[model samples]
Target: MAGQAEIPADVVALCDYERHAAERMPAPLRAYVDGAGADGLTAQANLAAWQAIRLQGRVLADLRGADTGLRLLGLDLPHPLILAPVAFHGLAHAEAEHATALGAAATGSLMVVSTQSGLPLEDIAARAQGPLWFQLYMQPERGDTLSLVRRAEAAGCRALVVSVDAPVNGLRNMEQRAGFRLPEGIRAVNLDGMRPPQIRSEPGRAATFLGLMDAAPRWEDIAWLKSQTRLPLLLKGIMSAHDAERAVAVGVDGVIVSNHGGRALDTLPATAEALPVVARQVAGRIPVLCDGGIRRGTDALKALALGASAVLVGRPQIHALAVGGAAGVAHMLTILRAELEVAMALTGRRDLAGIDETVLWGS
Candidate 1:
């Protein structure tokens, strides 16, 4: 598995893991992994927007020992890139979330296990050697949400990432057209036995799901959630500066500027486009992380230059897991770390902290 290079060298491999995953996965799984919400404009835009940003490279500086190390929410990470939470790893491979946990730990990157994951939180934690954060979905029942949070804390998860974007699933037209559904055997083990609420397809399941979302976590609920865990609280799916400011005001430990990988809202700004404004709003009071459309080390560098403490990758790692399980994931991280180092050297930045707004052009 280590020596295999399913993807060609000339291919600007964002992560070798994804290439392997694409080769191994069937059409249905591939479509599911690749599908975005609605027309997928947001998803497509996520990548496009990053390409739109141009970097100003510096020359003649001592770039011999560049570092990608970063400290986010008090945890030291080898790089400023993290694996974003993706659901139902069982859909990608047999090892499911366990393989991903092992791979993330192998490369010293953090993993945010999804509530919709196939494996239980405890099982993934048992295999993980690095930091783990639990991604929570505010289910219809508060008890279910609370139960999951408690379970994650018990399993040694260091933080709780409340996914605020998916109040309900987005209108993923591709999945709907493909008749996508989680296979029977691969259920969200965390929510097993207790059926939360059936998504009403007749009236559009997306709407039903959105309706159930606590719709903007009230300040009190945010306060209550914070009280529930000693771990730092991070609110995901934030896009606007207003929300970022509110998040900090309410005492959030961090804010992830994401559009749920453009899987929720179709018309929102790409995460990259929204990052600088939100980062400025947060003003270093708390960590500001960006997710959605990050496919290269340069993208990570650009985000860091714009004030993001770290960047989260959503689909690429899942693609790696689909192709080669744990080994694929490790390969993908290895490639990304190397690419990030190269980007740092080329940009004349010695470390992640050195990448500031000065490196960006055209705002």
Candidate 2:
């Protein structure tokens, strides 16, 4: 790739694969994938947050074969791993979302296909053998958003994931410096034919939130969206317990504690810091999942011990998809799963049920 040395067969870590993929990608797209908020503090925190708690591994336990299987929103996954929906996979490779979907299928991992997918939802769904969840970014018009949902349902998506934190794009220093623009060939193809609802904004001397997110959905909107579809509904980007409670009250089936990979708001607490509080707030009323800074199995295990029912891997899968297409996605997950199983065995856990807060050294 780009005259770079091919990825070594023994290089199992995601970071290594990412390095290999980075060699192939153009600078602007690399910045888009790796760059974070204003100063990248939040992005750094998403990775560093896991350092606070250490694992208390047990020495004297029967560590035979261990399983990492998990169920989220009624979908049984081979592991507690889900590939997070990231936009514009075409940036990494030519095959784009189709390759990523195939990778998820190969690993028996649940995949959340983004609203800004490079491929049509139907094509992605057809390629994924494992469960597919459509991550929704509401169109300015309600009917258009519902139309997208109907399309997902028709394409056999198992659940609907509504991203709630972003009304407007985050201020990304990297993208700004890189002069990032959607290159001529890549686009969010699935958004074709959607129209925006007219937004009325008054002339103002001071800033206001009203016009900030023209298509931003509110509580009533979420409730109405829930009523429009029978598919299991999940809310992503929830950081506060108050929001978690409101979502549960609004009848959402699950919650994903995320900080938009620290790409949205620059200074938000890492997803690692938010999951516990939200999990406590939900109080097992609904399944709670998490994403961001999940590079290793220990990181994932910590999320489970903190309160997540499962975890989603974003950049790692992208790296895999970039290098090996669907097969690359499979290899990346296989490595991640192996690391997780090793962590489980050393910690005296034989299965996911055996994992809890006790495994955390701080506990």
Candidate 3:
């Protein structure tokens, strides 16, 4: 609930918020927010991949009435950036998802609320002034997953972003090193009373192989869930052309090329690398969105040029929330949108449609 005054004058960009947030938050909390999987190769790669892409600048092109707006799944977004779903916002700010919702609404940015949100989906939906899309982690029981989808539909969620990667937690070594644990009273409120079916492994069998992954949702589960919900369904964690084609064949609404922010698995290809390939495979049959290592406006522009219809910003939302609560996050999105405009103006692109592989050098 912090006001605009809480936003520091020097915090002009998302990276600035990242630095301020580290100083403001507890070490363990920061570790949990920043940590990636083992060796951090993929996380580093995500950032580097975006940086490696070069934009082509144009001169003397008409730039009148430039726009950043776009429509996805029938929802009109003021800009192409979305607040990617991240779990347990309470770890960053006391207002938690409520603050994030207010911030997103303030700037007309769409937010995908996590299945593991610290606040109830209904409560967050009530506070959100803009659009809310629920990110679903399909449960072991079809009934349980369907119930969650029904709640989201009843709460006015515009879409369902089903995360399909990580049936198990990633090997987050940094979190382990910091001994990170969710503070008392902070939990996934939406998941309360829903118990996962037990999967016991016999002796001499690896539990992860024999039991834990048994709960992972398969392609059939996604198709079945799509049948149960009327909402536009998007599959997250898509990193390959084959999966993208499969998703299209399965009749899903959209695909988000992601590596779980490099938190799900190490050494995986960054979203920047995966996006173009997936976008090509889908062939515009569905919208392609991506998240991972998107810290600047130029990064978003790069993603779009590479075939992403829109890009999602994840960790930066937490960094902004931790630093200045709701206002901080609002300011963060404002900065990104402004930067996108600047990039577009310089690249001689009047609207998002003007952006394509042509904007990238050596395309």
Q: lDDT of candidate 1?
A: 0.82
TM-scores across all candidates?
Answer: 0.92, 0.94, 0.97
**Each prediction's whole-model lDDT (CA):** 0.82, 0.86, 0.92
Candidate 2 vs candidate 3, lDDT winner: 3
State the displacement of the C-alpha of residue 178, model 1, in Å, after optimal TM-score superposition: 0.8
Error of 1 at 127 (Å): 1.4
Candidate with top TM-score is: 3
RMSD of 2: 2.8
> Highest lDDT: which candidate?
3
TM-score of 2: 0.94
> Which residue pairs in candidate 3 collide?
none
The better-scoring model by TM-score among 1 and 2 is: 2
Rank by lDDT, descending?
3, 2, 1
Once fitted onto the true fold, the runs of candidate 2 whose alpha carbons sit more than 4 angstroms away are 1-7, 197-214
lDDT for each residue of candidate 3 in 194-239, tens digit (9 for 90 to 100): 8775778687875577667877889999889888878999999999
lDDT of 2 by residue, 234-344 (tens): 999999989999999999999999999989899899999999999999999999999999999999999999889999999888777777777788788988889898899
Q: What is the lDDT of candidate 2?
A: 0.86
- Each candidate's number of clashing pairs is 4, 0, 0
Candidate 1 lDDT by residue in tens digits, 1-363 = 343335444434754556656677776777788888899999989999989899888788787676788777778888877899999988877888888888888899999999888888888998788899999876666667788888998999989999887766788888888877788988788888654664444453444544454343466788778877788999998899898988998888999999998888797888889998999899999999999988888888888988899889889888877766777677777877887788878778998878897787753
Query: Distance (Å) between predicted and true CA of 140, model 1?
Result: 2.8
